[model samples]
Target: MKVRLGFVANSLSLWDASPAKTITYKRYTELPKEERMDRLQEVTRLNLEHTKRILYLCAAHEIELYRLSSSLVPLATHPEVEWDFHTPFKKEWRELGDLIKKFGIRASFHPNQFTLFTSPRQHVTDNAVKDMVYHYRMLEYMGIEDHSVINIHIGGSYGDKEETLGRFHENLKVLPTHVKEIMTLENDDKTYTVEETLAVCQKENIPMVLDIHHHEANLSERPLEDYLEAIFATWEKRDLVPKIHISSPKSEKAFRSHADLVDAGFVEGFFKTLKTFDQDVDFMIEAKHKDLAMLKLIEDLSTIRGVKRISGGALEW
Candidate 1:
């Protein structure tokens, strides 16, 4: 079995290379009318440049999986703000896309927690669709819409799992079919268990991105091993390996929170279970330390007897 590792947005190795820089709407309004769009463009330009730098670093290190920051363009889906973010940055987007394709990188986006289709309010569902379009537009502009994916949680149970899940299917109709094709669902730490999430993914015919820490924090009645085959089955439609989220808990008291680095001991059993399956998988490290955590974990895991360091960010066992 082999696993390719990656990290979340922002690499600590680079100085001031955060791709999530933002300009608040209030700040935008404070600017003079003539300077409002210019300010937005300025921030976006810096963000795009920083994102390109991060992608270059990834390619140099052979890191194939990366999660793009959702805030690449500020106020992109806001109802009131209407500024062209594409035409001005066509070259930047194309360059980033080119780097990703050249390196065979698997770039993806995970919208904020509010981007969910299970909400009962029509406005909430509308906002969800709009937010999805915002992410999709970024991929489309980069010419990676066909290969990238957008991952989101199963969302709040809203006091009734059965009713809320049914509402999820009904509310999801608002999203376009093409957008839904690249969408994936994940199990949340508090609300949705792996069983519930897998059932929903099966019903919706969408892929599932399993979070190991979340499963440990909020466990279901059956063990995770029982659901592994079904969870992996969700990715059959997509011609890609199954992806999982990896993180260690902050502490016993704040168990659901992510720590700065993943504790190898905490995931040893999970790794053992994964080794039983003869398949390739991708892991997105969700620690607070970002790229540093991913590299550190790779070094720690390489010491194992049967594991071989195949690349800067991949291992085979």
Candidate 2:
């Protein structure tokens, strides 16, 4: 069995390297009309450059999995301020893509919680579609739409789980088929459980990203072992490996909150269950410490008797 570990956006190890820097709508409006576009472009350029630097850092350290910041382009999906973010930075986008391909990095995007299809309101669904298109455009510009995925949750139940799920299926029709092809559904820390999310994924033929932390906070009726195989099977038809999210709780009381770093001991049992399947998987660390937590977990896991440190971000057992 092999596991490739990665972290979310913003490396704590790097100074001033956040790829999610942004300007508020209020602040944007405060700028002089003529300088609005310039300001947006300037912030986007810095974010992109920071992302490029992070990619270089990952490549140097043999970290092949990365989640791109969804805020790469400021006000990208803002109804009042939609703008062409690609034309001005065509070369920059291509360069990022080139580096990703060259280094074999598994890139992805996770839109904010609001970017979901289970909403009861039509405008919310419209906003969801628009948000998805924005993420798709980023991957398209990078020429990685075919391989990269855009992950999102099933969304709020809206006081009715069954009805909302039905509405979710119905609302999803608005998304383009090509965009849906690379989409994956994840079991959130609230609202949806693994079984519910997995059933939806199976029916929709979409991949499921198991977030173990969320699973612990919000469990299914059956033990994870019972559906572990099915969860991994969801990725069999996809081009990429099955991916999971990893994080430790903040405390016993605040179990749903992510801690500063991953507690290797806390996830030992989950690793044991995964080892039973003997399949390769990718772990996206959601710890607040980001890359540092991923590296620390890798080091901790490598100490196990049968586990080998294959790379800075990968382990084999």
Candidate 3:
């Protein structure tokens, strides 16, 4: 089994390189009318510059998987804000895509929790569609929309799983077919289990991004191994390797929270189980330490017998 490892947005190893800097709506409204656009442009420019720097860092380190910060453009999906984020940064967007293609990075976006289709409210569903379009537009601007994916959770049950899931299917119809084609759903830490999420993915003909941490916290009646093959099979049609989220708990008391770093021991069994399939997978580390945690996990896993450090961010066993 070979695994390519990556981390979420921002790199602790790099100073002031956060791609998620933003201005709240209140702050935007507070700014003088003349300065609001300037402020947005300034923050977005910095975010994009920082993102490019981080991409360079990834390329240097052979890190091939990365989650783009959804907040790359401030107030991008705000109901009142109207700005052309793409026109101003056309070259920047293309540069990022060029670097990603050159380095063979599997770029993706995970919209915030609010971007969901399970809501009963019409406005919530409308906003979800707007948010999805915003993310898709970023990918489009980068010229990577065809290959890159936008991942999101199945969303809240809203006092009823079956009804909410039904509503989710109904609400999801509002999304454009092209955007929906590249969408992948993930299992959440509280609401959806792997089995449930997998079933939904299968029903909708969508890929699934499994989060082991969420599965560990909210387990299904059956072991994860029971659904592992099916979960992976969901990606076969997409022609992309299955992507998994990896993170250890903060502590026994805070089992749902991510730790600063991944403990190989905590996920050793998962590795063992995955090895049986002998499939290559990409792992997105969701630890608090970001890139540092991804590197540390790779180091820790490389020490295990039969595991080879294939690259700065990959391992084969």
Writing each residue's lDDT as its tens digit, candidate 2 over 201-226 gives 99999999999999999999999989
What's model 1's overall lDDT? 0.92
- Each candidate's number of clashing pairs is 0, 0, 0
What lDDT does candidate 3 reach at residue 108? Answer: 98
TM-score of each: 0.99, 0.99, 0.98
* Residue 231 local lDDT, model 1: 93
Candidate 1 has a TM-score of 0.99
Candidate 3 on 39-158: residue-level lDDT in tens?
Answer: 999999999999999999999899999999999999888879958999889999999999889999999999989999998889999998988999999999998998889999999998
Alpha carbon lDDT of residue 13, candidate 1? 95
Task: List per-prediction Cα lDDT, in the order shown.
Answer: 0.92, 0.94, 0.93
Taking the tens digit of each residue's C-alpha lDDT, what string does model 1 give over 252-283? 99999999999998887888899997778898
Error of 2 at 13 (Å): 1.0
Name the better of 1 and 3 by lDDT. 3
Q: Model 2: clashing residue pairs? A: none
